[model samples]
Target: MLDDLFPILADPDFQKPGSGLMSFPAYVYVYPPDEEYAFREALPQLQERLRRPNVGQNSLAVNIYDALVEHLEEKTLGGRPLLDRILEQEEQDPEKVDRQVKRHARSEEFVEQVASRFSAFAQEEGGLDRSYVFVHGWGEVHPYLRASQFLDLMEPHLRGYKVVLFYPGTYDNGEFRLFGELSSGNVYRASCLNERLEA
Candidate 1:
């Protein structure tokens, strides 16, 4: 399936930023949970293929895990990274830590931080006109941050740039089921990249 996706990704005309079938320039590439490892291995190759000069586009692959780590580590509590604090808290009170993480992930502050990171990434990659961003590492942030929420908040930032999210789940119509089990709710704006490729 990923073999078929490469061409679409490399095609600047098809994945044209803000000019597709959907109003938003974001897309979700849903795959089975079991293929997670395979997907990870293939990601670099895919990015490399998209970055080739012949592809006629510049590509940037952002791992959500790395982005979240950078964001959280900058947040220090008592001279230690917030992630370190969370780890310690998890050892003593797992449920409490979980609740705190979940709450923070759902907050407007968190969304703004994420949006800032995304904007920086785009600018660093030579702006939206020449960059195609592929985002993965959803599992690392799951339960704490849902794909629906992330995509909804990211829709505005996605304007004028093609951003494809590598989702380990099922997206039927508008609803997204993370890992094909937990419902991340309906993501109405972002089109399914697989569907677009097929069409």
Candidate 2:
């Protein structure tokens, strides 16, 4: 299964216009949540493979979990990280803290921050046109932000680039069921790389 994935990912035409299911080049690679560790273990090797001859200079692998954390840490309220302020309120009102965090997660500010990080990484790592952007860690940033929502927000930023979302979930047809249970919603624009593997 691992061996087959490389050839599919390395295919230069995979991201070209009118390729496969999507008119755009975005893709979702669903895997069982139980196997997240295994996938993480193989991530470096997968990145290395993308840097090999046919795949281009190198791929930009962005763990959105890290991006979100960095964004939260950077955002300060009254000379303290917003998350720290939230932490201070946690004991006094746990529910309020949850709501506040969730609110922040769904904020345009947070979305833009994460998107900026992605674009910066893409630009620094050979730009979108010349490389693949492998996005993962959606599970960690869940409940607050759905994979469907993040991908939807990221669509404009990723217009010309090929993207493979290493989603720890299930995407059948246009519906995405996170962890194979929670319905993340329908997303038809991004092709399913798992389907390509079966093909």
Candidate 3:
């Protein structure tokens, strides 16, 4: 099933305007939560496959975790520097510091910053025909960055490529069950991607 999806991802024909796929340059590959490690380990092979000359054009793959960490390191949160705030919170309340940091991390401003930084990273890779963006480290960011929220904000700026999001979740009956966590709610949906994937 994973291999089947790769051709669709690398095919520029599906990326054209009114190609019957989603307008937004995003697609989701649902997988069992426990298989996350295997899927990540296979990324290099997948990247190699997508890089083949016959795949049509040069493509770039980015692990969002690394991008997010780089963004956090370079930016500030609230009025204080991000790292400084986290350290201060840790000293004042070690147990609750993570929660505090997550709360700040998920702020609209911060999420937009992340989106912007990701766009910049993609642009830096030069003009590629497609981009494969992997959204991992869900456990590390948790409530700070929900997949749906990030995609919704990112859809606007991420254009001109066939972008596939490898989601460790289930897609069923028009809803998304994120990370297989019951508490996370299966009511979420990415309208553009879901409508076509479900078809």
Candidate 4:
């Protein structure tokens, strides 16, 4: 199943994070496990539309967000989602969502750790997808995260990549602030793009 969908990531030719920047709108389409076949069937058509190997230096970054949700073995210590381990509150606590996500994001391998706990496919697929992991940690680390650290470490691997910010419940104070601090033009909002949710 993994081999059929992530050929680009598994192949030997894809660029690593630090080597060079891939073009924008790099779609890291993360689909929870059950949706695998639908996503797999759509890949070639989707890639053909947006991927531009001929345009800009290496623009046209695209990665499929493939994972199994149940593999995470996530459960509530007290009838709440395990994510509360970091949030330290009931899963329904909206205000604490952001705080909790940040509290737990300070690890040296935040995304990798999340993958370990939740998604079994992260490590291998990460390399295949040329994934740029995003994580929050220890109270508002979002504003201070510098890709340079990632770029320094990953340049040798991914060459250039992206790290989207995840704010759990709301998108209040994350990548929006980081991009503003860096004065960059590339910050995007996932909430607005979700047609299923209110914008």
lDDT of 3 by residue, 28-128 (tens): 66677788778777766777776776664444555655655665567776765667766767877876876765665656666677566556655565444
Determine which window of 10 residues in candidate 4 has minimal summed lDDT.
62-71
Q: Cα RMSD to native, each candidate?
A: 2.4, 2.6, 4.0, 12.1
Candidates sorted on TM-score, descending? 1, 2, 3, 4
lDDT of 4 by residue, 113-139 (tens): 443432232244421343334332212
**Model 2: pairs clashing at backbone N, Cα or C within 3 Å:** none
lDDT by residue (1-199, candidate 1, tens digit) is: 4877887776667756646745777778999989999998888877767666677566677787677777678878889889888887888999999898887776676667866656666666442345567888888888788778888867666645677789998877677788888897777777788787678
TM-score-superior candidate, 2 or 3: 2
Better of 1 and 3 by TM-score: 1
Instruction: Give TM-scores for every candidate, taking all chains together and pairing residue i with residue i.
Output: 0.87, 0.86, 0.72, 0.29
Q: After superposition, how far is residue 115 of candidate 4 from its true place, in Å?
A: 6.8
Q: Write the per-residue lDDT of candidate 2 for residues 1-199, one digit (tens) a residue.
A: 2456787767777645346545456788888899998888887888777776656646678787777777778999889888788778989999987788778777778778766765665567443344567888889878777777777777666644567788888877678788998998767777787887788
The local distance difference test score of each candidate is: 0.76, 0.74, 0.59, 0.33
**Candidate 3, pairs of clashing residues:** none
Q: Please give the lDDT score for candidate 1.
A: 0.76
Which 10 consecutive residues of model 3 have the lowest summed lDDT? Answer: 183-192
Candidate 4: stretches off by over 4 Å: 1-75, 83-99, 114-199
